[model samples]
Target: MNNQEQNMKFMQIAMKHLPEGKKILDDKGIELNMDDLQPMLELLLNVMSEAYELGKEESMENKS
Candidate 1:
């Protein structure tokens, strides 16, 4: 409805699919250090940008 309500709804939906903190290191044979966090974040950013924009487009229909 309002900006605050919209943000809360977005967070609630996003949290369901967010990776658990420890999951970033799930590969057994592969190891990652602090340097890996940036690349991981970049990949996630691309996915989330598409997801959030698609959600916003859907919400615009409701607002109309």
Candidate 2:
């Protein structure tokens, strides 16, 4: 997938799990805030994107 598609997919996956994450934090007496999570979420997106690229490259190399 292209960058935009990859980002969208990553965001979808993150959002899917966000409620569970919030619940875990809530159970631990931690408050979950979107503003506080923005930076962390960005970092996670970057990591996921990079990992996807790396895996794609590896797959292509294996097919060579």
Candidate 3:
């Protein structure tokens, strides 16, 4: 697939898992403050990016 298709696929999968991410924070009593939401989102995206890369690497290894 092309880069755009790959990105769309990634986003579709990510959207499905996002609720679980929020649930984890809710369980921990982490309240979402609008004032700090942007930074929190940035942090989440950064971590998710690293995690996706690691997962992609592992999946490629499995295909070898």
Candidate 4:
């Protein structure tokens, strides 16, 4: 597929997880109210950020 198509597919997959934000937070040891999911979503973002950074660091190490 073309770049645009691929991007759209990836975005769709990502957005499907919007409702699971709280589940992700719960799995990662972040407690939050079920009524409000933003906190869990924020925690998920923090987790993804750290994971991405770690992945980049590993890639750099492998290249060296």
Candidate 5:
């Protein structure tokens, strides 16, 4: 997929699990405002994208 499509997919996945992330923070008695949330979400997306790339590379190596 293109970069835009990959980013969109990452966002969808992140949003889907957002509630779970919030729950974890709530259990820890941590609260985040919008400012904090934005960076956290960006970090999550970056990590997810890197992980996806790593897995794709591994799969290609295995196929070879």
Candidate 6:
């Protein structure tokens, strides 16, 4: 289990989950079309960015 092997395995598992995730979203009435993907990914990225920033701020406060 070298780093490359581990990374490949992780990616394989992640790829398998992608369709399951899309299925879940589709069941919830979300669209998976090309027109919808951009906005959907953008929204997810924005949320992840905000969450990362919040976590960083919390870590800084804890260190003070």
* Best model per TM-score: 5
- List the lowest-lDDT window of 10 residues for candidate 5: 32-41
lDDT of 2 at 55: 95
Candidate 6, 10-54: lDDT as tens digits:
455555556777889899998787566656555655565566569
**TM-score ranking, high to low:** 5, 2, 6, 4, 1, 3
TM-scores, each model vs. reference: 0.52, 0.85, 0.50, 0.53, 0.86, 0.58
Model 1: residues with Cα > 4 Å off, grouped in runs: 1-27
- For all candidates in order, the CA lDDT equals 0.61, 0.88, 0.69, 0.65, 0.90, 0.66
lDDT of 2 at 19: 84
Worst 10 residues of 1 by lDDT: 13-22
- All models, RMSD in angstroms: 5.4, 1.2, 4.1, 6.9, 1.2, 6.8
Cα error of candidate 3 at position 10, Å: 0.5
Candidate 5 local lDDT, 26-63, one digit each (tens): 89999976677888889988999999999999999999
Runs in model 2 lying further than 4 Å from the true structure? none
Choose 3 or 5, whichever is better by TM-score.
Answer: 5
Among these predictions, the greatest lDDT belongs to 5
lDDT of 1 by residue, 1-64 (tens): 7656755665555455545543645644456654765565556656756687799999999999
What are the clashing pairs of model 2? none
TM-score of 4: 0.53
Ranking by lDDT: 5, 2, 3, 6, 4, 1
Q: Write the per-residue lDDT of candidate 4 for residues 1-64, one digit (tens) a residue.
A: 6546644554555558765765777899987775576454556555655676698899999999
Error of 1 at 25 (Å): 3.4
